[model samples]
Target: MCENNPVRFIDAFVDGLDLDALGFKRVKPKATGRPGYDPSDMLKLYIYGYLNRVRSSRRLEAETHRNLEVIWLMRQLKPDFKTIADFRKANRTAFREVFRSFVRLCRELDLYGRELLAVDGTRIKAVNNKDRNFTKASLKRDLARLDERLERYLKDMSEADTRDDDGPGGDASAKKLTEKIETMKARRERLAGYQKTLEETGEDQLSLTDPDARAMERNTRVGVGYNIQIAVDAKHKLIAEQQVHNKVSDLGLLTETADAARKTLGVETLDVVADKGYFVIEDVEACEAAGAIPFVPKPQRGSAASKGFFVKDRFRYDAKANHYTCPGGQELTQQGGKRVVRKGVHVIGYQNRRACKNCPLKASCTDAAFRKVTRYEREEVLDRMAERLADRPEILDARRETVEHPFGSIKQWMGQGAFLMKRLDNVRGEFSLTALAYNIRRAITLVGIPTLIDAARA
Candidate 1:
């Protein structure tokens, strides 16, 4: 007779896993005395789900019923849907801790070298559809609809009143009309209250499906999604930090992601590279202040430079006199200066058109009879940042290698567009798990599976 065969895929995977060493604890002692499943068994379920690309809790629950690996992992114990979902919901904080522990293990394994870090954000579709997004314009339209209904109801009431009363029926009709009017008024009030809340909050319309997520444009073809940002180390392509935001633009993400990378590495400073989308003058200044060297390409809007016309760069600045010299070597005197608000920030503008009209390059410079140029009062600071970026050409190449690797892997693994979770927090947790899983794969590949198993055992 053949020797009894018992070793299975799940058993092989869990052979060396030490749940306590990984910082996973059993549910509280007071929990209903249902024979508590081992935390390691649950961890095995998640790892199997991630490796097989089965991310849904419901799907994972089904896997326990049929999948051979899952059955072996759970020792033929099929958990109900509530048990699986509750585990994920209640263990969110603990799962985050587990994620950090894995990162520490990766560091111990030298998977991340803290040399070059790249930052980028990708939009993931929320459970909410675009039609659900309520903007000020949409709210106005809704209120107009309510107003029209109210007017029609009032007209009908007037028509009913004009008719001669024949009996008690007329009295009942009038009472019904009054009730209808009261109902309409209540609805109108509710709509008005919603409109006021929208206007005062200063946020774009919200998604009822996922309140924490806001619709954001990802690209020309993709719109209305959550922005998920990640910082990846150049060496071994391990994710250093990650965050989810409702912002459409990357302007505010650069400094925050760079600081996260720095904190993760426990280093004073690090080199951070990002694409043009992440470029913001204020963010650049913040990065410089934090001692992190940021390499972000400036976004070239369809201005003079992009249109082949003379750009501000062609004009030179005079530090001593605090004025700009036109391309034609004419002095642009400050005809007037005033502080003005733009994008919620106060900026000073200087203008001088008298010297521009008579200049030989006026045609290439501007269509106005006189060429007018205004600079941000803090333009000097931005200029210094540009100069710094100009000196580091290698940063652009490093950005390609550092940022794209993890994204390529993740996209290949997860497929394109949207996510498995419906809510923003759930999506975030899912993404965190994905990142943790990817880092684990990287760690295993870098230090060898045997070493990681040994560390996990320790």
Candidate 2:
């Protein structure tokens, strides 16, 4: 198998194509500092490493020396670990372009379906731990602890000053206590400085290891990590776009992911589907505005289900009358036109306070004075999507099958906390490489490696 390894396609794909064309900066080094390795060669080495799951820089350096397939791929030029690492840092942007290049290549090969797309986010563990991540509350607790410790130190010094007789240990002990007090004071100052840094940056969370990492909750487990969002095409299951976000919520991510898929597919419109997590009203409006139809299931918000009262879905809207009819026979009329509910969000309130006061359903409807149904400014857009979903509810099933495939496959490549790079930017580069490797693996699996190489050659 080593004699005729299919990974040779990776070599042919990297070398035959123009690296500079793919945005990798080519080096034309003069007589200086032991002539740098060509950027393309280093890129080849990384592609090979990622495909084989040998992601460590030091291990890649070892492979250049020993592994026969790698030797053949890199042409016996054994650049050390530092050199290999430097190539990744220097050409981080190139990795992204390379990912796009493969996407375009797949498009040329008719691998991208360009029709149905599923947008989703998966949490990839960051190098930082929960202990390293600091929230404002956590910082306040630390400061409190420091305050107590400082008080304890001051108490010891006060007792020493009043005691008048140094028992057992003598005057040298008092001198040691003075040194310890100074040390404790300095330590308290350092904690205060850290607190100031947190306040100055206005960051809700801080990580000592990976500063960009956040304490994100995904499903059941919470950890210091990044929310990696990707839009996967339904046909060949190629990733259309990959984005790294520190924000934990998938609420408003649908539009951005959908629009990105539209751009990558180079299509005028897209048909997107996601889970209830991405069912933001604004995202649905943006998608429809861009000619893309999103089929996200509207999230079940409010306590109506638990309270046995009428749910939002139970009420019917009258477009002509511009009002809502409750489960009870009462009209909920608009209180105002488009109004700012919060920053960047708008709502129109609907209430029939007089009708509610006299109605029999008032007790079930609200614990408040009356029932107020607030409609978002773009509720019409959501109404359109709801109509779309009622027509094709099976699209949700299609989304589950299409998008989750790539995520499950890629997660197998990343073990527990398996980001090999440190900073957010470097991890982005590393993930780009992972996405490229996955695309290659997908292409080879769909068509043979020989056919893939032949396609690249053409």
Candidate 3:
């Protein structure tokens, strides 16, 4: 193998790590039983396989015999396909630790800037297909359609029974209709059972193949998959932290992802920026409390925005006075009671009903008697963040530029658009290797394999 080959760096990197401490199994060979392949060697094989875009265990087994790089990297030990597959399934959770170990090595090498991070999520198709996934709403819709068909079939059968032209063909037609009706009834019963399961479990959707996968919408296309979240450092666009979630949306994930990345980077304070999907107040507040400064644009979501009326942001709030100056130059003060928006979140409604009775701007402001602007109890945090965003608006564009590179490369260049594993943990392990390969390639491109090998040893 050449000195600059990434296979050499992979060997050096795995050799330096304590696999037992990182949770790899069978670290020590047994005394009485058959000898097993060393975990470090297996780890090197996987890293090499992923880096070369050959992820299947059978393909990897073939590589050990045919490919010169795999033969040299693994020392010509070709574990069968089942053994190779079992290694990953048995030590699934440990892959994340290995990924973080490499991240720590990169941090030591100054590959991470540790100042700012861009957080985003993408939906990767799972082993489950869309037809095999069902939500409560979909189940109900299917049952209703079946019921309509059943009604039509029953009516046809009744009309056929009244016919007096006795013939074998007529009887056969009626028998076929009866069979169709029975099939539809059986399907209806099955759908009802699914509905009952959903009600009992309190889950929004159910996936037959992979129970951990969910039906999620991405880029206006709906599919059954897992949401993959990543926090990328601004300097190198390398992923600092990655997590797989089955959630349908990215509402409350900013804090957890950014906090983990912040801890991995070993920074006291870090700047995190995301898109409007992560604009939940509780999440942003939690992210800030976790020592990350978050900048997320508030989404324009409300009846007013949908109806072409003035949005809540148009009314400027005065904290000291506890009132808002509306677009019509009128003061709207907080009303008497506070309403609970969500858990640990309360908002007070503000309105100037007396002034709006005759104001000419009422039509544009609201269709109701007056405009009511609700303010959260912790609205000051959002206000401060909005001020920060206004001052440094370029960070939003920076966020887009920083996070999209890794996702695009992983999906487009790496041929990892869909996961091959069945369960969540297995897919997580698979992605961990994918991410590790991506980072390794990037580090080698930035600073050659020789430096990485030296750093690994150091």
lDDT of 3 by residue, 1-458 (tens): 99998888999999999999999985323334767778888899889888888899889889989999888999888788877887888788999999999999999999999999999999999999999999999998998899999999999888888875368698788889989999999989888888999999999998989999999999999999999999999999999999998899999999999999999889999999999999998999999999999999999998999999988888999988999999999999988888898989999999999999999988898888878899899989899899989999999999999988999999989998999898889999999998998899899989999999999999
- Indicate the TM-score of model 2: 0.87
| Candidate 3 weakest lDDT stretch, 10 residues | 26-35
The clash numbers for all candidates, in the given order, read: 0, 0, 0
Q: What lDDT score belongs to each candidate, Candidate 1 first?
A: 0.71, 0.81, 0.91
Give all candidate RMSDs, comma-separated.
Answer: 6.1, 3.4, 1.9
How do these models rank on lDDT, best leading? 3, 2, 1
Judging by lDDT, tell me the better candidate of 1 and 3. 3
- Best-performing candidate as measured by TM-score: 3
**Regions more than 4 Å wrong, model 1:** 1-44, 65-68, 71-78, 137-197, 302-309, 333-346, 368-372
Sort by TM-score, top down from the best: 3, 2, 1
Q: How big is the positional error of residue 17 in model 1, measured in Å on the Cα after superposition? A: 11
Kindly list the per-residue Cα lDDT of model 1 for residues 1-458, writing each as its tens digit: 11121223224445554556645556422347677667667766776677568877789989999987678668887766666666665545455555556666677667777877888988877777777666677778877987898798888888776776657688888788789889878867876776787778877676666666676666575456678899888887888888777777788798887787777677787778889997767787788678667777777564677667777777787878877787788877565555665664445544466666567887888776776666666666678767868998887888788778788787786553566556666666677777777777677567666667556555
Candidate 2 local lDDT, 1-458, one digit each (tens): 34236667877677676777777764433336666678878888999998888888899999988898899888888887877877888888779888877787788788989998888998898888788887888778887887887788788878878987567886888788788878877867866776788889988887889988888888888888888888889997889888777888887887876787688678898798889999877777778788668898887787765676677887788989999999788889998678886677898889888988888877788777888887887688888889999999899889989877788888875442458777888888988988888888898888778777777777
